[model samples]
Target chain A: MFKDIADVRGKLGQQQYIASEEIGTVVYLAHSLCKPILAEGPAGVGKTELAKAWALSTGMPLIRLQCYEGLDESKALYEWEYAKQMLYTQLLRDTLRNVLGDVNSLAEAASRLAQEEDVFFSENFLLPRPLLTALTSDEPVVLLIDEIDRADVEFEAFLLEVLSDFQVSVPELGTIHAKHQPMVLLTSNNTRELSEALKRRCLYLHIDYPSQDAELEIVRLKVPDLKPALAQQAVAVVHQLRNMDLRKMPSISETLDWARALVALNASSIDEKTLTNTLTVLLKYETDVQKARRMMGGGDDGGRHGRYNR
Target chain B: MDNRVVEFIRGLRAAGVRVSLAESVDAMHAVESLGITNKEVFRSSLRATLVKEHDDFAAFEELFPLYFGSGGPPLQSAMDDMSPEEQEMMQMALSALSGRMQQLLDWLSSGEGPSKEELEEMARRAGVEWANSPQEGRWVTRRMLQQMGFAQLEEQMQQLYEKLQEMGMSQEAIEKLMGVVEANREALAEQVAQRVGQQIAEQRANRPEDLHGSDLMHKPLQSLTEEDANQLRKEVQRLVMQMRSRAALRRKRGNKGKFDPKSTIRANLRNGGVPIELKFKKKKLKPSLVLICDVSTSMRAVAEFMLRLTYELQDQVARARSFAFNSDMQEISVTLSGRRAADAVTQVLYDIPPGSYATDLGNSLNTFSKKFMDAVDGRTTVVILGDGRNNHNSPRIDLMKDLQRRAKRLVWFNPEPQRQWGTGDSDMLEYYPVCDSVSVVRNLAQLATAVDRLLTER
Candidate 1:
């Protein structure tokens, strides 16, 4: 999928995804070794985005499976398409009667029906979910399993087989291995500890919040219309806010959104009045807004205006 | 497998990073595929194969350099570059040294002190640098032994001592020289190890990322920075989620609570009156909780975190009443439940006025019992968070026992260490027996574990 680490880095950069060298190296290795990459990090650090960017860079279709509580094989791997199976049974009722026309005894009829059961349980009735689709696709895909930690432990354990061997076993059809060997990426928010068996099957990568310089670069790329100085100042303010004892620090995406919000307002720089007016764009919790307001020396309109004028 | 890679894997295992046999084999293949020419690629490849969890990344990073660092200073022959005058002076000093010491020095300079190859192997395994020459190699061996600590050295030193005594040294003379030999060995070892460390560091110096995840779990809450606090918050949230699932699983396994005959019969009417699927009565009762927390300065840090836990777990309990107190008690359940967890904690801190800087548990209990006596019932579980310190005042032990009698269970969580429970002004010793359970919660992990136990028990 990638010639080398530099190639991976360059391609990701072209897709507007700034990856660290560690990330590029891991991606390169995962591609060469045909192993899945398990990306763990706090929310909004671009764990899912990395997979999306990889898809865009490689021109491969992206298959995503968003995990949640009680997620199971039927939802993630494959299902039988029960409604389709029912319709098929109804449609095939006449054909079944014709095929069994010569049968007289009940045991003979049952034996004939059993022999024809494979038709109903075959691929025609299989509804391929993300995992199966990724495996059975004609072209390699970028398979993203987002927030996998939210899934139940049993579901995670079930995933271990498919991830390690790139194959899924169906009771009726036996095991079906991958044809294209898709590039798989699993992301976790660390909501729960993932099982060791599942984690050992993949390459581990952790994505943390970007540093100041990196965040500035991201802001410039994401909100190209914003002034350089204004973007720099906004990132600086966000950094300061993160250091504060707030409920939720502004993530990188929030920083970009705040920069865009400032640009839309035609704000030249991060003044206290402007920041106070638009703090909600960055901080979701009211408590954080109040804390930021206090840290900026209160929400007094006159004080903020006087300081900005000077 | 590359010996260095195997050694690196051993180091990783020692640092608590698990590497299974399969993973080690895969890591070897990955290294071969990626090639070791590029340090970044090799490191990432090995890491991707060996490290399974996010937290283990730090251990991998720390161990990588110690194992794969470029060869240390080139090996040199002993006395090859030394001037004749220096060599003569060294020999003269060796002659003046004790016979046992001289023999040991000869063993060292002749490249036979405890086997240089074995010492080098030990150094490589321990991630220490081996000296280049025989003379320096002796110092490296001694340094490595010292680094292994006195207990380990003592065992090896005993064998060496026995060997020296067999070489015809007097008991008194041997005892006299033993202390000097040990002291000199330690000093030379320290100096040589420092120099070797500097040389390796100059070649390539990299420090792993700072402590995170489990490393921060047991640290004191008061010392936690914003980053550490955020990490702890995430961990606590994860624990709460896990506990919720565990409780749900337990409920499912114990689903034979009460037979719902009506529902069962209605459902089985289609199956010719054969009750194929059984249904059980669903319990409608929710657990009630009463949390009494100490908001004094000493307990405030952990108190806030505990309050956060209670807020997150409000759904698990039917009715949760939170009370914060220092010298006086005030119900803050409304504030805690009305807002986001972080906001609620901050708001509660702001809403409650700071009481006197002393913990008056007796007075607080008296206030709670007087005003909220009716709230305690057979279904309610009361949790008290404090150091059990009473400022040397009356503990009102009778009231505690009475409350325990009324409530289903009374659990106490003390942030102070267990050894300090009865010392100072703490009334823990007197009040401990009255409560159903007493847990010492000094950090987030213990706090989470205690809460998990509480949830599961219910």
Candidate 2:
């Protein structure tokens, strides 16, 4: 229900998510065009948060499908509740005998029983997963397919149908159409190249690590109680760490965690001692920590630093 | 405006960004709905709809402006900001210019560059359609600029500035007008050059003789330039994706495990113990690999791509330990894990600077067994990528033989052609019988096939 790109930004701000203009514009277009937005970026950026915030801002429910390897239609779309159907069939055996009573010929009894077969395959035995629920919802919702790259290639191909048409086919129920089209966002970590077929159907947004000013604003916004000067220095250091070729780049989530940790430790500003103590909070690897220390002009005796720097 | 967007997409395609028809239509719809009221929104709309790949974004950013920038500078009519008397002075100075110069003056003041059709016609007149490659685009663009008298226009603009002062225009007025003219001329030149070059590229892209990515496949790996190397870097991802889909279609046994009847029965027990839902045995625990690559200048291109594939498809392998050697050897698995593969290759090479240009694969293997013997186990596939020339150094097949005894599969990739094997002090034939498989990989296609065979044959 956002009126414009500015309106999207304003509404998302109400949800405490600071969106860049590019993100706002893309989200607005995806809404207007009824297209899925394929957001690709590094890990721990606010890709999943954007969908959550959009759902909150719009007062729609959030329907999430976490895709992974071996994710198939039975898991993602809809599954037949075979156990329930079997229980019902067992209970209805006497009724079936009564219905088939007084039929003389075997063929006649078989024909008579055939008329009642739709009972078990009806909507009562259908279990709708996230994809089906999103399509068949009576009201519009936000559908987030997270870590789609982790899904097998076949699963990605299967999604193309649901994405392009906003409809899905259930063998018993026929093709189900969306009463209200959901605003869908699919996020990828760029672990692999998505097929051209899938990319062609959706609007694309690449959310890289935020710029320094943006990250500072994000940290200050997300963690309100931190002192402004401390937040500034923390963001500055995280930015420096991001610039380094670490095994794992410290993302915005890590920055926020670092800030919260700094506050919890009662530290007001970053110093050599504090940085070394909290280094584990910012970086994951010992090699990465040593490299950061070396870059901080804090030389260590380990030979790993030599192999890394060279 | 849509015309400009269309040209922009074409220019993007010519620049090797794959903008499909569906994406192009989406871009158009995005633009049409956003309205061009805000240039930033318009740009974002186009980018989000048209560009999908992270790698293509750089191309999109580079070409977006060339198609969408105004022919002239943004300031419209520097004289309009002046007092009425100064405007009259400007009109008088403009009246003295003749024909082309006058038209050029008027166009510059308008801030709308020459029309697209006009640029197209000029490019055609310059015979730029004959240009069949992006590398040749710059040359043809220069020819088009020469034909358009762009060089003379710069000189004439200077003359016009002097004439304005002589005509008694105020110094401030003269300065403003001159600055606008110079900026406008520069913008105009850039506009023409980019458009002409775009046309040449489109011409080349449309031709059937040189398919976009296929050309790189046949070219010898040794002859690949740095630009070609970057292109190959991007292409490697596509190749892998293609192979993945193909493997899925064929149910490639190398990467995927076979049907699990036991697991299928166990899983389907929930449904009357029937086999309506069959399950696949999960792909065998991903096989670990040890890659020994030659980081010598001669093998740099092949080795970089090999690392690129590994970095991209890292999860496919359980654990990979990489070592780079020309003369001295260093374990680079940790180094490669620090960054993306493209930069990782350069980092590894920088870390282990080539020694004497001497390739001692034998000695490197000796060191590998001596210090890092624990890196290899029966589950590891040991792949050594080099020419096997060894620069006449000791070809200690004994070391290779010893390593082979401890490893699962010993595979050697010789980028040298089959005819050249054992031509010099190759040491290829000496180590050949001891190895399980030796693949002759002379070009990208061969390399891809060899890698495919090695990875899938297991």
Candidate 3:
């Protein structure tokens, strides 16, 4: 457990995640209150990374559930091991016949088979997925539901019921409650609006683009071999690009990658030619690269491309 | 539950942040666990519990300080820094001022204005209870401040500064005092505004639900402001979800797909392959769409909104390819992917500057047929969103016929009234024969109805 908000920052810092005061405070309260934290922002701002850092800092086993469209309960929560159950029934067919061999009436024999139905539906045949694993774990864990916005709205309904109570009901084995309620962190890219009912049960944390100084620190920490001045220049350029209203703003990890790429190339300065060569590392979209080059001025070869030529 | 936190939640709600009762309860729980001794934690506790959307983060940041910050200016008073002899001289100079100025100086020097009750009374007297909206709250606060003599109070502070100079106080001392006085006056004005805002929020919280949906659906798209557009974006998202759930229920009721042997065997596992109960697959009813929109100035709002709705419902459709044009066309399917529809609209609208709008649907259709002819197939439903005023250009009826031939069906949503069709340059009459359906979609209700027909008639 965190001693205080600052302790959260300190512990997470040791794990190499530089948390802002808001992030630290939210993490602290999430631990104390035992509410899920719905961390949302633009991609690559470390919404997922923060969850990882928290789990590491707290020494909790991390269980991640990656969400996509049409995500459903059988995949996320639990699934019946039908093949295993079927194989068991086949192997035990003669043994079952022996138990029912002395039955006089057909009705009594059917009842005897009915009494043994629980053997297949029991916990041995229930394969626990991330949600059920996190809930049923003996020790506390950090359940990270990554990119939850990508999941269908119906999946959110399944979640709304499960999150309100840290328990899952299997018809044969009854309700399996959490021995230690796992700290849940759900990250979103803000691509789709999450239902308000789900938000109501969770603590909401919005992580935007970090401050310039923070980015500088992050770059230096991640790519220690990079020159200090080049790191500063890279952070400054990222800040400038963030305000250009481009399709995709460069995220923190992109900045770090740029720094690392610059180091790998043994580059000491961030000049126009160097930036053009390394721009692809920062921006994924060809249009975004052109826009960044256009904004950087001195419209070089990258900016002269016909489609987005200014 | 803390009263102050409750009041802050009310302020957030009235500010349109939509903090629900469950969120407020969570906020109180967070605050209790975190404790209020650390102000940053306290703030984060409230924010994490109450604000769930990035759009509301700014409002929370703005209102948090106003609710939780200490009631004092950031400036320090010169009197605190002054020697006893100099302070006495300054005191005498302020005391020499008479009536309202003297009383004002006394309050400013004390670093406290009228108490909460007094401020509330003044705002009540300013009719803040009658101020229903935040804009009206601003008006009431301004009036309340003026009535409280804040305007004259500025002049009084100026007079005091002159008196200090006349009384032989140092120039530096006088400047320092001025900073404190200005800061106090600004703080006093803010207090009035905050109190008025709170009262209005209190009144709003009592009256309940937001005014949404019905009127907005009937209101024409062109008249909606940016805020209304944002609200409508949420409405569209909700509409898609509602329509999806309803579709799901309908499917669950009667619709069945291919037979599944595995599920049938599993159902009759107890009876050794004696299949009594059977199972059928859930039908996948997703449709593919091709949306071509005229984003000229007159049709821009309608086009933007139509594209926004299409993008929100993209999940329901197996595939959606969108294009925007004024005098030229660009395939925006890539631009609109993996982004919020509202944000994507801004980018698309930015790329296609409204300044060069010529409403040349004829030219755009030619561009589409030449460059994007492969996008349409036998199963595609090509929907055109426009007002159909083609700026006196060629109608290009041959291209429209070709598109209708390639597509499963071509539907047109013309916002212009039927009487206005082909009156001047509109190609609606010419394009009507080629289209499978032409629906008037001036407002959201009509637009939704048209879209519903497009989906259901499939």
Candidate 4:
């Protein structure tokens, strides 16, 4: 849908997703080349958000599959609806009796039954999961496999065949190739190393934490009612906290959450009391909160209150 | 695909980034669709196709500027006017250096190894002072290229350009010469950088031993300098990962011993009891480990190393609890439980200062029995890391006997040499009889072997 890199950037911006030139170029290439993209980074850097924004910009349906440890092919690709098949059997009893009425012998009845066996395993009885749905859709889609690192190695190996061929094989229904190839985006949090074979078949993009200017733009975009000065101070404090040795550093989403919280409290700017009260919004762990508190108490320039003094 | 792109891919592979043939083709297609006029788009296209991991991104960034960014301006482009006499003089000067310059370029482009004498001669001609310091060859080659008549060439070109302008030559002729000179300069610089990079790669491939430090596995821990300790720490991490994978493989193989016929039949009942879905017996659970380490000054390095290894291997065990002591015992499982391995090691070191008191194994064991005995059970394997040095205060043989009775087994890792046991206040002999097994672990290799045995035996 994009004419060039600038077109991609502009469209993503129209959807309220601020993309760097690097992201724009990669998205354009992946679109033109008809390849899957593997996006790896720390958590909450908008890896999943990028796919949603792409789907919105292009006006395509988004099919999402959230990955976990025991995910398997039957869950991801397709499964037979056994209960539906059983109900169909009960409803078709009169029809089956009519079809076999002319047959006299038991073998002749069994042969007649075998002739219509494909009815139970047709498309109506086959339930397509995210992978199969994306492949079989008449219109192109945006398929997002989120947190792929949580999936087992066996599941990853299974994904290799689907991603490369854009087709899935059901034992009953033969191989089904994509009618309109969907744009695939797989996001990982680096929980485990993905297989090299899977990585080789796809484009790779790493989205790190945004720069200070980009982050300030994100804060303003996310929490628009907040004053510019308060947003800047909150971003500056988050930047400082990231530099410190904490168990879990605050991600970009946390920064936005903190900014929104500050705006809700009717605070004009960040100060010691405001920051201390809203610390939980930024940090998840008590140890981190205590550390941030100690850092504030040490009065290294009188903590967040120092911003007001400046 | 352009040959320049192929050469850039070669450079990337040499720098330890794995770029497969399919990826290279993909990169070519990407670059073709998105033309190379825009620098940002071109770079991002290649990066998305060629680089896979986060660590390889740094290597890609370093190689990009050297390969694709070399096609820009040279120094002489800024000076574009010269007089007739100065132009003549510049021509004569270039003729004088032409032969040696051609020879240098030929040697560089030959793709054959040049001797030290030839390299030194080239440096001398370029007016680069070859420093005797042991620095990287790439840096030295870059310095030589900068010093080589590049600055003089710019000055001479400017003088000649002005001299030609004053003598009424056409603007087009002077502009053409300027472009030629600029192209030549860039080509020379690129050739030099490529040669130096190749030479460095060759040297590294020739001597692989220099990459890893000298025999870190067998080096005595007590005598380790800070650098040696850092290297050993990295080695220990690698060793721990290998041990963990091996244990996991064993567990996976052990899980297939016998099939549960009941589960198989019940699971396949939907398919008319043909037993399509066979279920095997679950693997035996891995035993938990409780480590009691001596963190006094004498045993600090080895003890910390052991703790780091055990913590890294925690995934292979059912559960792991760590305790540290100098003169008294402290259960540190809470401190080290959920943190990163490096961070946990740092926290343990900070929490337990290396006390100056003599090694008091007896007192530490007594404290463990009195306070943390509830942590011990028949399923827990107790690993005691110390030299068994008690300073002759008390051997604590009775406490050792008690621990052995309660735990499944007691394994003692003595950092001191075995021959030195029971001599000079060492208490290994007294504690050896009560312990189920005793191993002398003076270095990382020995420690790894002992740990491997412990893991496999379980």
Candidate 5:
């Protein structure tokens, strides 16, 4: 429904999510240029969800590559189908015997088989991975390269080549350019600095947490069935949780999850008893729970407990 | 621009021939007076504008030839009648220019060429531009010449053509050479111009273009911009005001607390459980600070960093304060101020009545404690700056002990030699002990560590 970058940003802002200008630019790039957006943010902030939303908005299939350390080209881009390769090898062995090929030295036969492109790395045997699949898909696709920072630098180097030119080089199949270049989005959590060479090729944007009112609206949007009082309490409590010195602060997704959990409890107000029972969903860490409990005065529900008791 | 006095001051600042404001102004004046047509006159004017420090002689040597000696200025000049040494330099200038231009051409053609004269010159000086090439392979050099944003090169080229006419090159040949140069220049200039935007984009893309406090504080993402200095000054103001409030509170501690009769009776009632002692512990607000800063030339890119830190401490710390020097010694703690931290710092080194020489830690510690020892007390903590380059400065242990003896805790933070310490002028060895803790502080990471330790102890 959005006409342009401004429109998209305005629409999102109307939803009260407050997409940063950078995020708006990237969303515009992905939608207008039809490039797969690679979103890299810390766990729980909606990097993966952007792809899903794009797919939902456009009615396209969302193809995701959840990147991890040690992921190589075969797993991420493409691989030869091993079963087909073995079948071809068996057929060649049977036919070669009849064709009087066995008289040649085993070395020569092996070399000949290796040299035959069809017998070696062939297109029929090519198992298209997310990158290749995104390129080859007949329909529009959202290829999400998630958590690329965790991927090895070598993988990043490999990705840079594909990103610069939406073409993958296969020694056997020759170069494969995307039939319709999918919208490419690459993300990083900025755990380590990206190389300058790669940075020059792509348009980049960084996403930060939304403001308090925006976050409250997000909770409402995600869980409209939850009581208004409970939603407000959950947002307030989560906002306070974020300010604490916790190892992993509660992210927006946790914010929604805790709201949903609270709503399921049929709690009209967030009493100390209900809070203690449901604290696990909010604070993932034991130390964080302990710290929160200490702030709450050891679950004693002190004299001035009207806010907590609702 | 022609004021000899202003020029002299700027010249000293331009040491190593790094172009400064005075040079730019002079170049602009030369363009205004002589017209851009006389290449030799223009080159001479530009060179004269920039020639300062002894180190700058090399840069001038590189740029002068490229500007004036590039073409048509033959072996036989009116200088042919002058000194033999003058003639040799002219010959060297011509050949160097030709050779450098050829290298620039080759770099443009191959898209990957070793830094020719043009690239190297631009990289060294701020305003000079021979060619700008980054990333996207060689394009038509002529387009680059036209598009490259540097007006200096264009003005210089106009001078070159005008000088060619003066040198008696035929109009036809001049036109042909101009055509060739113009084509290559335009091509290269366009590419370079495009890359200026790309470089800006690349800088933004690689880092968070906007920092959390970017709008408020104005800290630039890459190089330290004027914005960073302004924002730092703003932050320093806020911090100083906050510290002033805290300091005011510290001063009024006892007077603010009048005896409460109800609390006194409550305390006496507690003695019914046989508690006898009624004691009033004075609210002692201790103030101390330790600053360790990076002063290496590379770190000089963020030279304002330490100045800002010192400015912050001037208000934050309640002290009889002490500062020691490195590489060499001077305590300018009294000179440094939070309000004018950056300028005051620059003023101290380059503008103070008695200017500071190269840093020397050994001499500084001995001098500071010996000269300013009366200022340090049980309430004080020592702050030292420099790369800890003892730089052959003697590490007098006895003086360090005497200084350390005056303070409750000695704190030394070295910007280098993180794990590997006590090498070179970093005689962290001599001062490591008399101090309570010594940290090899580098960047924000180390600063965070030092701040943590200071606050935790507090």
Candidate 6:
């Protein structure tokens, strides 16, 4: 069941192969010991897809928590339904009045009001957020915390407490422990370095770009209708483009898009003509496209006539 | 499998392997799909997959075999086909050709060796801004020239010099071109050099630049420009080289004892000319260092240089271990394992993840004792460096005893200074204790004094 990352590597071309020895070893170790795997890499390098694939393989739903700059305890953990609390308060007023029947004192009324407030804000009124939901859910889940680097350092430190114990602490509810710990995955783009404390809690793996041959295989797999020659040509063009100092390098997804764009234009080959019209699929930024066009000796009019001008 | 190979190579490159895009494409078509998993297969696969540059092949071969761990009997069969003398000659030729080819490729990529029109076009691009002010134009031109990688630029300059000679250009013209190229090359190198030297200087100058935590705290803040930075770097390089040369010369000259009247009288009392006691002062300098580096992103490039400086000091300095800090601190002396200073620097900088926290100078001092003070003794001197912007983190003063108790002298190298110390979150005012000396370190010149102080202590 555990395919060696190298053996499986032989099945795909260099660029399309998603797993590395480092990544595979961590995956194998995570599965064996049931440790949470934390995959950190730059965006567009496929961190979320790996977790999704694992969930599919295990037949479990992938539970995602998209992290952002302002993610806080209430949003990530749990919060009470305030309207429900008010409705419950109204029902309790009528019931308690008949049951207790006038213990009429100002001090007693004040004390009762404070007691009711505590009851209203208790655990039963709380709504479970992704963390609590994943913990309490009946089925096994793959918990993915995407773009974790965007979150603040304090949040990372806070996450450490929950990640380490598979339990979270709430001021009103105390600690809610996980019945069965979900497979936790945290990804980052290395915007900032992670703390050693946070790193110690999970196995680490870094994902990077694919090689040309691997990329070629990926193109073939994703676009079977395209000619092998055209696919190879598009891969070659992408490879060349990667060498240039562009703002955003074409990703594997972009490579497929470029190929599809080439195919859709009814081009049998990736000649200079098709390249000019299809350059948009390869490069997103206007500045990047202009620079690439200049490099290829093309006109600003987006004409493909300049292919092989060099 | 073919597609998979391409993806895997790209992935490895993305992980910081420095694989070129062109090679990745070449590798894809070069190797047919194969189930080969052995070292030989993998090696061949990589060879098929990678575009081999001549000089790089040796390093590639070494790394390639090692990556797979015992890949078949090393493939030296290609060498076995020729006579020993012939093989040696061929190898030398290949090395030369490869080196030259790489140099040519680098020169071409750098926008040097462009056609005259292309050169004019590049100058015109700079000219657009030059229209506003001649000085700004010059600056733009210098920046454009600096945009090319230093290694690439230097190689291009060398090639240009060679071509000029081949064309029999006037000696004056050749020298002029060399000067321009050298100046431009120096500017590029200075960008990184000034950045590195500033930290060393800031530490020496005993000043840290203060920046309050606010929306207006511009980074690369009031820092040295690339040109000024390069000059400082050259100054540092020249100083070190001069020191090394002077030391060597001193050793060659042997002992030249100066006359001492007291010693002479004492010797005469003991029966002199006939027993004249000659006094000679020892010239050997004692060397010890304490490097405290800020590893925040703003200070990252500077931190790398300090790491390199640490590695360089390993052989020269008597006792040293470098520490890195952001919100926390870590001693990275263990990471400096290799021969090359740059290699050791990269290994440590890339491997050690700096934690997310503002500069906590006071806490870092407390941490030093727990992590490093035991290893230090009375002979060592301290060198503390930071922007002095403490970010209001807890300042633990009692722990400053590590510097007070163990160090022969504490040198707090503040990148900012007395003027900026108490302005913001900078707690430099609180760190006056336990410091035997403090300097405003902002350039290479300041580091010279710090180096001298460390050397003279012995």
Measured against the true chain A, the candidates' chain A TM-scores are: 0.93, 0.93, 0.93, 0.95, 0.83, 0.84
Which pairs clash in model 1? none
Shift in Å, residue A287, candidate 4 = 1.2
- TM-score of candidate 2 versus the correct structure, residues matched by position: 0.84
* lDDT tens readout by residue for model 1, B177-270: 4554455444445444544443343223233446667788889877887657766776776777677668657755655569999998887665
Encode model 4's per-residue lDDT on B20-47: one tens digit a residue.
9999999999999998999888999999
lDDT by residue for model 4 (A263-291), tens: 88999878889989999999999988988
Top model by lDDT, which number? 3
**Of 4 and 6, which scores higher on DockQ?**
4
Who is ahead in lDDT, 2 or 3? Answer: 3
Better of 4 and 5 by lDDT: 4
| Model 3: per-residue Cα lDDT over A140-195, one tens digit each | 99999999988877788889867889988877788888999999999988776788
- Give per-residue CA lDDT, model 5, range A67-172, as digits (tens): 8865889899887665556566567876766554655687776676555656457677789999999878887676778878667656778887787688899887
TM-score of 3: 0.86
lDDT of 6 by residue, A1-310 (tens): 3454454333322334355454554554455445576676545666787777666655578889998865877888887766566567567877768644676887887787777667777877889889888888887788998888677556777888778788887777678788877888888765444554565556556566778887787778778889998888888888888876566678878888878877788898766778888899879889778878777754364344334221
Error of 2 at A158 (Å): 1.1
* Model 4 chain A: ten consecutive residues of lowest lDDT: A301-310
CA RMSD of each candidate after superposition: 12.7, 5.1, 4.5, 8.4, 26.3, 28.5
Winner by DockQ between candidate 3 and candidate 2? 2
lDDT, model 4, position A256: 89
lDDT: worst 10-residue window of model 1 chain B: B71-80
TM-score of each: 0.66, 0.84, 0.86, 0.72, 0.43, 0.43
Give DockQ per model, in order: 0.36, 0.59, 0.50, 0.40, 0.01, 0.01
For all candidates in order, state the fraction of native interface contacts they contain. 0.54, 0.77, 0.73, 0.71, 0.00, 0.00
Ten contiguous residues minimizing lDDT sum, candidate 3 chain B: B70-79
Candidate 3: clashing pairs of residues: none
What's the best-to-worst order under TM-score? 3, 2, 4, 1, 6, 5
For TM-score, the strongest prediction is 3
